[model samples]
Target: MQFDKPATTNPIDQLKVVGKPIHRLDGELKTTGRAMYAYEWHDKDVSYVYGYPIGAAIAKGKVKSIDASAAKKAPGVLTVVTTLDVGDLKKGKFNTAKLFGGSEIQHYHQAVAVVVAKTFEQARSAAALIKVDYEEQPGIFDLQAAMASAEKPDDSQEPDTAVGDFEAAFEAAPVTLSETYSTPDQSHSMMEPNASIAAWDGDALTVWTSSQMIDWWRTDLATTLGIDKEKIHLMSPFIGGGFGGKLFLRSDAVLAAFAAKAVGRPVKVALPRPFIANNTTHRPATIQRIRIGAERDGKITAIAHESWSGDLPGGGPETAVNQTRLLYAGANRMTAMRLATLDLPEGNAMRAPGEAPGLMALEIAIDEMAVKVGMDPIQFRIVNDTQVDPEKPERPFSHRDLIGCLERGSKAFGWDRRGAPGTRREGQWLVGMGVGAALRNNLVMPSGARVKLDKEGVVTVETDMTDIGTGSYTIIAQTAAEMLGVGIDKVAVQLGDSRFPVSAGSGGQFGANSATSGVYAACVKLREAVACKLGFDSEDVVFENGQVRSGNRSVPLAQAAADEGLVGEDTIKWGDLTKTHQQSTFGAHFVEVGVDVSTGETRIRRMLAVCAAGRILNPITARSQVIGAMTMGAGGALSEELAIDTRRGFFVNHDLAGYEVPVHADIPHQEVIFMDETDPMSSPMKAKGIGELGLCGVSAAIANAIYNATGIRVRHYPITLDKLIGELPDVA
Candidate 1:
């Protein structure tokens, strides 16, 4: 079913199920511990072995030799699979570095070999016995050091955009502000580590893994193994958390497959927490420069954003300037991203990816410009809100409510209570409020699904869409139920199996709307098929209460499919609508922060986000995504940093203890409000993604709040107390 046209009054518009705050369908299984994760999948019928991966000690080097004799003699050791045995295996398309690096180590902690044993403890203890000799070589470990000689990366994902003459306009403008900001690399720090259970049935291999994209992983695993794609089956029904870390095929899956093949038995592998940082991907560190020229009346005349980030060779830039090209009204606007080569772990998508860090820098620059002009920050943003894309005035927004979000959020957050920097003091704590406009473009992708109606009046939706704690299973069921006019309990959702219809697996905040729309399309077809079987006109048939009604005739839906289950499969192919309209989600983040006068410790008092992201599929899950992103943004603003060890060429703070995220105590009262709205150009669901929208600009709001409380502006990220302590007012 092609979604080439705008959605009309479909059955989903009834809002009987889709818009409700339905509890997660998988909640019971998850809470009861009945859900099976990758590492826990055990087949008692078949003797299962365990694989423990050994990582490289050196960052970049050539393998002198690997001695596995000691490991072979270790207790219960089955077999050792090394890169030498694999012999230059084909790298997966999604992987930036070779999973099993041997002669040329890409980065520190890169998996070099896997030890298989009868038990996990035996395999782990034996893996320590294997030794490797490496010759360390000089590698570029620092982004600043590498930026000097940086070359354009071959895999630049997003191109540059320019409009009018930014430099000239900025120079001519009387009120202008220019600043540079830096954000360090960040880890996903999800609960479940990258884990996989691989079992071989003759020539076919079945892998149960924790992944965000099942079909992509299956295809990539087959490509990397040089095996037939049809021979590999991947399943990932439950995931603890992803945050974009599980978007690709990790080493655990590949290593488990190899170990299972070597030992001729089922094998499971889980990467230790230490391997997560350097072994997998992370959000790359970025150095961004934002320049804004505004009039005395708070109108933005010129805007320019340039960002530099480093990744391994043949990797892509962070595209940190993406939102800057379209967020505001600037006659002369320019945005560019440059990439440098660094011998660090591969940098890829994490949570909001581009906008999360991009807005951290851009929005704070807006705040600084507002301060320079002696204007209210919220008023400054509202004055510059663009209905059309600033870079392309010909393209107008499909739906934009940024002004509404700001206005509503301001009232809810008590914006008038905010005072000048250092003016509001409560004993030893200086309190101030800050607000930032949140913007993230609504991205659409072609998604497919298969809906089956059984004789038992049960509707089953099959799609490879993954949940990843985003409540995908529940929302998808709701979409199907609403479309078929059936109770939510009657709909069963099957997901995260490569054999299912390929869907837009969860990433980039596009998964929720696109995947659910695909299910809606399929359910529509199923309703038609059932109506046709009952000799009813498909166009005029009404599917309600498990019954199909057409004209004067009515029949139970089960009766139409009594002979055989009715199946409908279709893909929701997008049209040029997205190209014609600038589809974006808008929100406002308001934060109240208190800074300790003596120690300079900043703590959040309250945070509120008002979002206008089209029709929400499930308010409960949408709020979950927003709050989760808010928590993550708080961490990004105050704590989360992947401390790089330049000398060692790896992240020094690999474990959670060293790298801090927001805990319950760190995140104060957070409130999220979703405006009642819909966009016909978005999809049949009239829904846009809110997953990443909540994260964009949140860090900047925190940064601005810190500045408001202390009268000192810090450009660097993680906004450490050390940066504020020196500039703070002298303690009495």
Candidate 2:
């Protein structure tokens, strides 16, 4: 099914189930601890061995040698698989670094070997016995130190964008503001670590893993194993959590597969908590410099954003300047990104990626410019909002409600009550409020699904779409139920299996809309099949109450598939609609913060986000996603940072005990508002993604609020108490 033009009236327009606030269908299983995760899978008959991985100690070096003989002969160890044994295996397409089988170490904690044993304890004990000698070399570990050698990367979204003479425009402006902001590297820190259970039967291998993209993992696993793609099977129905860490193949799955093949039995491997941060990918730290020139009335005349980030060789930049090219209206604008070489693990996607950290700097710059021009922050943002792409004026937004989000959010958050900076005091605390605009690009991918209508009037939808605790199963069931005119109970959703039809997978907030759109297309095909089987005109047939009706003639839908289950398979292929028009999600974030007068400690009082992403598939699920993102944003603004050891060339705080995220005590009440909106060019569901949009600009709002509470502006992220104590006003 091709989506070439704007969508018109469809079954989803009925809003019977797809738009309802439906509870998660798998909620009970999760709460009861019945839903099996990767490490929890149990096979009744097959004996399973445990595999423990050994990671490289040096960040960059060549292996002198690895002696695994002691490990193999110790305890109940069966065999040992080392990178030296495999000798330069092919790297997976999605992986920026090699997962296994390499003598050269690119980063610290890279998998060097896996020791298989009858018990986990034995495997762990044996793994500790394995000795390794490495010839270490000095490597770049600090982004700021390596910035002088940074180079411009080659890619479509590699920044370096300009429309007009930004320098001249800025020089002529009446008011101008320039500032530099820094955001440190961040970890996914999801509840579930990378884990996998692999078993082999003859030439075929199957893996049960915690992954976000089943198809990507399957393909990459096959590539890493040097086997045919058909020989690999991957299943990841339920995930503990994956911000963006599990989007590609990880070490656990590959190591488990190798150990299983070596031992001739099923094997399981789980990366220890310590290995998760240094072994896997993390969000790269960034140094962003923003310059804004505005008229006396707060109209932005010139805007420029330049960012620098570090990554491994052949790696991409952090792309922290992407949102500046499109977020607000500026006649003369420039944005550029530079990539520096660093060996502190492979930097990759985390949550909203470019936009999340980008907005943390850009939105705050807008606030500072607003203060310089003597205008309200919200009004300044609203006045600069662009309906058309700022760089390409001919391409107008398909549907944008940035102003609506700002106005509505301001009212709900009581913006008028917000007093001057450092003026509003309540007892021992200074209170203030701040606002930031949210922007995330809407993305569409070709997604496929298979639908089956059983003779018992049951509808089943199957796709490789993953549910990373984002309520994917519930909303997918809703889409099927709404399209088939059946109760939600009559639909079953199967997901996260490579054997199923490929989908867009669950990253970039595109899963809900793209995967469900695939299901919608398949359901349409099933409806037509039912009409044909019942000898009714497919065009005139109305499916309602589990019956196919045409002009007073009605027949039970079960009659169409009484002999056997009817199956419909189709892929939703998108056209040039996305290219023809600018499609993006818009939202506004408002935050209230209280700063301790003497301690300079900041605490969030409340948070509200007004979003206009499109027609939300399910309000309950979308709201949950928003609040969770808000919590993460709070952590990023106040605590989260992957502290790097510049001399050691690795993240110093590798464990959760050292790294800090927001806990229940740190978060206050959170509120989310969804504007009434639908984009015809989006899809048949008319819904854009809201998950990533919820995280964007939230941290900036908190930063702005803290600045309001205390007259000190924090340019560095993780605005810890140490950074504020010096600038805070002296207390009585």
Error of 2 at 61 (Å): 0.6
lDDT string, candidate 1, 482-508, tens digits: 888789999999999999999999998
**What is the lDDT, from 0 to 100, of the residue 75 in candidate 1?**
95
lDDT of 2 at 617: 96
Predicted structure with the largest TM-score when compared to the true one: 2
Tens digits of lDDT, candidate 2, 333-390: 9999999999889999999999999999998999998889888999999889999999
- Clash count, predicted structure 2: 0
lDDT of 1 at 170: 99
Give me candidate 2's TM-score against the actual structure: 0.99
Q: What C-alpha lDDT, on a 0 to 100 scale, does residue 699 get in candidate 2?
A: 96
TM-score for candidate 1, please give it.
Answer: 0.99
> What lDDT does candidate 2 reach at residue 487?
90
Q: Give the worst 10-residue stretch by lDDT in candidate 1.
A: 150-159
**Model 1 lDDT at residue 694:** 91
